[model samples]
Target chain A: MRGVVTLHADGLSKDFGERSALRDVSFEVSEGERVAVIGPNGAGKTTLLSLLAGLQRATAGTVSRPPEEIGWVPQQAALYRRLSIRENLRLFARLERVADPDAAVDRALELTGLADRAKDELSTLSGGNQQRVNIAIGLLADPPVLLLDEPSSSLDPRQRAVLWDFIDGLAAGGTAVIFATHEIDEAQRHADRILVLGDGELIFTGTAAELHAAGGDDDLVVAFVRVLEAQGH
Target chain B: MRWLLLKDLQILRRSPLLIGLLVVYPVVISLLIGFALSRGPDKPKIAFVNEVPELQQTINVGGDQIDIASYSDRLFERVDPVPAATREEALQMVEDGEVLGALIIPEDAGRKLQTAVALGGSAEKPTVEVLYDASGPLQGQLVESLVDSTLAEANVAIGERITEVSAGYLNILLDGGSFSLLGQDFDILGLAEAERILGRQAAQLPAGSTERAELERIRRFAELAVENLDFSDEILSSISNPIDVKETPVGSSGGTTLESFAVSASVVFSLMFVCVLLAAGMLALEREEHAYGRLVRGLVSRGKLLAEKVLLAALCALPVGLVMLVVVALLADLDWGRAPLWTVGVLATGLAFGALGVAIGAVAREVRAASLLAFGLSLPIAFLALVPAGTVADPLYEVIRVVSAAFPFKPSLLAMDAALNETGDMWPSVLHLLGLTAAYGVLARVALRRFG
Candidate 1:
């Protein structure tokens, strides 16, 4: 179902004073493509997503679409814990300037499979359910491109499976999903393309099998490590 | 108890903000208030309507000429005088709050006083009017007392002058007389008898004689002069109390002192504390819960987001303010003067202080910090704003006035006073509140960008 490119970052660079957080980072994500940005700490994974979302100003770069057209989900819950799940969705939906907020909230709840607990406050929900509400807010505007920073870093195995399944549904519906993660296996299994970052630079961009051949290792984790080590990360 | 105390200490140690609120805030407020009290209070200006400035003439007093017309003008050192052109202008100044009270000296007052002093007596006494708003009893009484003291001093000076003139005339009369009785020279009756014989002789021969006509004029002059001296006792008594000082209450306050205080205190203090806490706590909670970032990233602009929070705070404070007013009205039987205007004043006060609270929240890093900062400052702000003009040193009061003017505290209080008391105009306060709201709103946005 992948089609024309829906997201493009060209020569993106972000600098905090003299130290660079992200430099010359470039990538293209097509509709329905799941791109995983894999990097160690301080490798600018979050910075890259923030730059693409226009929440931050890049030192030098350009994004193809306007910032409003892209959905951004940060690492934290970043929600009102006292409010119910449906209330949270409706508030964000209204912020997104959706034509019909109630309809948008309903769709987000159904898409996240959280309709049964829609009335439950986020503070009372389990970790996985809270994460579902987080993603639900990002999906409120139905942006063609979704950027999540570590979507499943804190979830259990079953919760992680539920999250990836939900993401797969979005991708299948022609929404390009970009996620930053430390899990190499997750990147290999779920990503249509893997972007390896080393010291604020893009070191590799290829499929899991192609990365395995280049890294001279069968295991995806070894390949990811080798890819980073080759660039002296 | 020791273990519990230790546990409480451990909890307190974790909150620097609470410690600051309990320790530093009080010390700072105390110092400020102590400093203000150390300086003497400034006097409010009283308007003076001198209608006889042109009749500035000197009269003889105890062998020395005194400028009687300028005596009252020189006696107003205790209270600053704002010279008004007319009685109407002076009263208007009081109504407009330009001056706390007005003193109106009626037309030809100087001429009348001069003539009375020259003739040594008069049938009519000139009166000056003192006008003040009855609703502001404290200020009104203060102004009235100052005017009374000044007029009393003027009366003493005039009485001394009159006594000196009478003494001078008594010496002249005794020197001119030759008769003596009971060890005191007495000649007024003998002189009157001689003048009566001269007038009788002159009348018999005054058909066509120039000498007889001259004798008649001399006799008439002597007779009138003796009669004027005979009335000296009455003149001396009247000179001691010449000017009539009348106190006129401009606007009536049907309530007691406690009722007036209830209206002003409830509006100013309640709105200030409530609106500030509500707005600051709201933003602090949002930041503490990690939702502020998400909110900023949404489609709403930073200004609009701040506006929404500030508006919510103000709206919430409005009911609290109204409830306090209603409760006080029920308990104290107070007249809320112009309900619609008072409501507007309350709402304006809320909006202004709510914006200030939002600014405080934006600068603070956590909920506790914001709460402490808002609560810690509200009481002092209210106190300084309501510290009745003359209660602090002139320089300190000037600084306080400037600070309160820049903010919405004093203006809102004054506006509410106008609305509730119907003593002056309320539009100025509303205008100031709106202006301050905009300024604080902008400050909140800037702080959010820097610290939020």
Candidate 2:
């Protein structure tokens, strides 16, 4: 709690027409904290990530953070096919008006382990490399907070492991890491705290041990199921 | 901004065909029109047969010389004339393929004139029997008028000589008052009225040396009248006169040809600007892939993203516009003085159109839709701008004027026209271009807020 508060969302809610995508959600993650938000499809996990990322305005609450302080890795990587890896990074750096772009780009590529493949076009790169470039683009400015929205959604198990290791390294380096995923097991392995969301509301927010102890002899998935059952998901 | 511009340049380098079409087509058309069609005089040919001596004299008086040497040369090479051995021969020639028409003068033309004089009434008309090929009736009519004018001048001259002699003999008995010639039915009498009046005035003068002063006055009057006779001729000549339009620049020294070249170049660049903006497909691709979500999470404000795209589009459009401007100027032999004005106008137009393309692309949901929408909107606008403002007409013209006022290319065209021809003020065109650019800027901002 003494660490710098990277993100502080209080009573965060979003609505599309009459349907509530996120309802009165509150969460906080400090520097060096790794929080995994897990939920079934349409349970507002992505919506909460969007809200925290400042991608969308919360209809009913305040989500505050430092300006230009968030780095995001989207679920699909979203690399430009027309651009080379280096060119894409260069464009992002230029658009963001990053100071000393050459060094920033080098650091991003080095961090993502894509320094050697920078010359290749994005279309020619493998899905995993492209995802790494996407993450590299996000990391170019060296922001204090990092948000990954199912960053490993389309990767193979090997690719996912590589991505997970990259995320772990960032969290270990004092960057506040917040990832949203449908993969409960992966979240259990990497998350310092797991927040379970059901029906547009948070059902559990504690360590995996506490979650398991509260619902005995059950996997984190079963425990989440019990929590959902109690909450009538 | 630099990196984004460089990226667009690289893309343009990769796609050479699109760039070539965008920049070359307008230049080619301009060169073709400026050099090839902008020459030569509007010459229309008329064919005639010379029969009466007076008719032949009138033909010589007019500037059009008879082209009678070779039938092929006369008819096919613009100056048409046909020849014949006799009056009947000429009529037959006209009926055949040899001539436009024939003018048949009566064999006893002088004798018929004498008979008319002796009888003191009009004699049988010395007919100018005109014959023509079945191709056109108008050509035959024109030939008739030519013969009629020749005969009319002859009759007037004969009448004028007779009246002069009579007036000289009668002036001694006349009182000094304005006298009107009464019942003078002879064509020669009417023609000689001016000379008869002069003769009568001379006779009425006293028989002394003062007659010399009267003679001097009469001589001066005749000279003045002759000079005044050319007034109708001057008016006629001025009516169909040609003017040489020349262009010069206030800021630079160059030739008029450079201004034309700049217009060509500007058109090429305008097209390229529209094409690249349409082809970039950045926003549509992002929306299609749902990557807007990613961009938002990266702390990229929508305003920043819009600015980035506009910067990229300007980067793409400016150089291509310059390249086209230079190439066209060189090829079209355009005046160099107007080059700066043309360059600025073309580049600004390109930027505005580029922004519009991006804004339209952002509204579209897919790349195909974006391309279709951008192209569909720009094609008509480009065509409207391409048409000369002077030639525009009707409701369509008004509509085009309003639409083109907002379209980037329109102001560029007007600016090029002014620069090339030195015909209008450059400031209005500059203001129009800026207004269009600002309008596009606002539209792009709205699009970014709603869709980016």
lDDT of each: 0.80, 0.62
What is candidate 2's lDDT per residue for A37-145, written digit by digit as tens?
Answer: 9988899988888777777778998877843678877787666787777888887887557898888888888887877888888888888888888888877788788
Q: How well is candidate 1 docked (DockQ)?
A: 0.38
Docking quality category of candidate 2 according to DockQ thresholds: incorrect
Candidate 2 chain A weakest ten by summed lDDT: A63-72
lDDT of 1 by residue, B1-452 (tens): 99999999999888766777888888988888778766654456778887766535555443356776568665566777789998888878877656778888877666666666666656466678898755455666666678888888888777767776675566456335443445576445455666878888998994879989898888888788777777665657566866778888765442225446557766788788788888898888888877776677647677987898789877876788778778877786556557778789888998999899999898876877898898777767766765544445657767777877877777777777777776577887899999999999999999998876
- TM-score for the A-chain in each candidate structure: 0.97, 0.95
Q: Residue-wise lDDT of candidate 2 within B92-200, one digit each (tens)?
A: 5544434444444444443444344333323453333444332222333343344344434434443443334333323322312232345332222321345457666
Q: What is candidate 2's local distance difference test score? A: 0.62
Q: Which ten residues in a row have the lowest lDDT in candidate 2 chain B?
A: B241-250
User: Model 1 over residues A1-233: C-alpha lDDT tens digits?
Assistant: 35799988999999988899888988899999999999899898999998888777789989998778998887888789899998899888888899999999999989888899899888998888888889889889999999999989889999999999999889999999999999999999899999988889999998889899889899888878888888888
